[model samples]
Target chain A: MLSKISFLSLMGPLRSVDIYQSLWLIIEGMVGILIVMLLIYLVVIWVNKIMNKIEMSIDKNR
Target chain B: MGSFSFITQALGEITLPMVIMWVIGILLIWLALAKDFEPALLLPMGFGAILVNIPHTGVLGDNGILQWLYHAGIEASEALPLLLFVGIGAMIDFGPLLSNPKMLFFGGAAQFGIFVTVLISVLLGFELKDALSIGVIGAADGPTAILVSQKLASNYKGAITVAAYSYMALVPIIQPFAIKLVTTEQERKIRMKYNPQGVSKTIKIIFPIAVTLIAGMIAPDSVGLVGMLMFGNLIRECGKLDSLSETAQGPLANIITIFLGITISFQMQARQFLSWGTVIAIFLGLFAFIFDTIGGVVVAKLMNIFLPEDKKINPMIGGAGISAFPMSARVIQKMALKEDCQNHIIMHAVGANVAGQIGSVVAGGIILSIAHGFGL
Candidate 1:
């Protein structure tokens, strides 16, 4: 797709025609980070909820 | 083997490039001692450069201590860097990040530079593997750079390590400039209040493990990298292994660091590191950092557009999303304070900084995942 941009000439052996794969890597890599980080966030929230509840029960017993 | 002939052979082996490498080595040493630029790593790497470049040095040939260290520590299985990750994980306090869990998004956003640099490197004619290695210099974490490049077998490993560590040292200098490029004075002055949240001990204990499982499941290639890091953190938070955690955080980490720098320099033989590719790798490394800052800042700004005014994040916090850790977080705080003395954003920035730590490793894993996807 990049090859059609007449103004975007590449200097390497991997021409614009070869860049579609690279573009995909870039796209998925960023999205993947966002997804993974978000998942981690959810885990923290989930873990906190459970732990906080247990701690509250222990305090009531005390 | 005669004494007279040995002198002649040794003299003949001396070349201008070797001298040039010595100068470069000296420059690194000077930076370490005089400028305090990553003294722990640069000092030894600089000394190693001088040692390896000596003609017919036993360090490069059979029975070479340096060569043995390189093969055993790095090339054999990435043991040293991974071990170092445990120490790094132990040294981290995830309290800030766990409290401000939302900062994790900034971590993902800050890795924008790595991907951008990969495309740019490919555009400039680097083979995809070399381009990926070069781009990872933006990870802003040294061990991640080394492990990624080594695993990928990038020909530019030495240059990538040098670039990664050097740029990390220059974070204070590089980040402010990059943050300035995308933000105005008004935006820089954007104030965010700091509210300390009580992070439960159990949550702290579970965080690293949860991060590993979550990150590992998505990118199995990241298990080693992510798992080791989280393992180190577990020791720190487990509450029962204080001494073990201290050892991991102190002595073990120190000894490994001492080995890591000089061992990595094995690849910095004058013949390997003096190429045009090294120079290009260095420049591309800078761009990765710049682009990372842009990515994080832009995302934060975009988020501001959708949020209420009182809830707007000081976009500078996004720049701290690189894995440069406390340094990046500290820089953001310094910048915030400069804008307004009462503006204390250290907690928020620390949250993002630590998240960057995870973000960078995950980004490295993503690169590995992409590499695997291509069947490389």
Candidate 2:
């Protein structure tokens, strides 16, 4: 963690926050999107699978 | 004696890295010619690979021939990929996706790889910008990856480019495992009917233009990629411009593809590209690609619940959501065939494939904007 902080400091500050702060924000944002997107996608796929099973049963009965 | 000694000294300047580059160069030629993965790209890439590897060839020596071509064709203007897009656009048919627009989600879902790769890259100690640039490999869109790499100025250009194309070639192998892992045998057998007749020619023509305008408005950063891609499609779908479209889809595309492939390989020499970072980048890239498949398929299945009785889609096409183009779509078709041979899901798969192409560019643009916003 100390080395990571020093590495960020060496990169110099171009944005509003310090380099370490900015790197943290960027990583946080990316992870947020990745997790949220995966959750949404998985939920959708599971729901679809359940519905398909019900639909198949109905069609067979008809 | 002095003159002879000077000449020998000049010969000694050739580096061992350059020798290794020569071997890799020959391998690319063999892969292109004998294996025939993508002959158009591999051949020129192989040739360029050889040219650049020669110790004192002066091609990339200082300001030599290959460098001139690289600068003029690729690096200077970034014209080749965009120009090639016109041909690709002209060659595509949007009828399938138009008939079933829900597959658009698949395209959007497949882009999960890029973001996932970025996260893993950061974990492995890569900087945010470089990781983002490298993650575009999972996008499965070569031009998009190049566009982002050039914009970000990531130091790992050669490895990034190879990772993008190599994963593309490996699609046939990678996608099946992904599809099967996420989907059960019962889910694989799910059938849905799609008819191309539902899509009118007017709609086909309008689809590309409308998507370009809407997508551009949403993500202005993607104008170059989305605009060029749509422009190609416009030429393809338009009733007129047969000659223009033909040129775009034919020699123009073939020539550009050759240059693009070779130039990428030229960047892949062992000296510049062989590093621990290279290994990490490839591993992270494969992670992105696999996740994208999961994301897309899962999204498609989720969308199925909202549909009325007859409208449920085969979830297999979800895997086709990545921007691997026709290859991902073909994989979907094969998976469906395995379950039920007569099930013709190619149309649905293609719809998702093309949509994935657009979705990837949009995601690439969004990443660029995010990076820019953070002032990185």
Candidate number achieving the greatest lDDT relative to the actual structure = 1
TM-score of each model, paired residue for residue: 0.96, 0.82
What TM-score does candidate 1 get on C-alpha atoms? 0.96
For model 2, name the residue pairs that clash: A44-B302, A45-B302, B45-B262, B87-B248, B89-B232, B89-B233
Residue B237's lDDT within candidate 2 is 81
Which residue pairs clash in candidate 1?
none
lDDT of 2 by residue, B1-376 (tens): 2456756764686777776666766776787678765556656666776676665656665577667666776777677777877777788776666666666667777887687777666655677787788778988887788778867777787777767776887888888888787887877888888755355566667666666665566557767777888898888788798888888889889888877776665466556676777777777778878888887778777877897767777888888878888988998898899899988888889988987877787777767766787676
Tell how far residue B226 is off in model 2, in angstroms: 0.7
DockQ of each: 0.65, 0.05
Per-residue lDDT tens digits of candidate 1, residues B27-136? Answer: 99999999898999999899999999999998887699999999999999999999999999999998988888889999889999999999899888888889999999
User: What TM-score would candidate 2 get against the native?
Assistant: 0.82
lDDT of 2 by residue, A1-62 (tens): 44434332222223322344445644553443344334433433444455567777999999
The runs of at least 3 residues in candidate 2 whose Cα sits more than 4 Å from the true structure, single-residue gaps closed, are A1-62, B1-11, B195-197, B269-271, B305-310
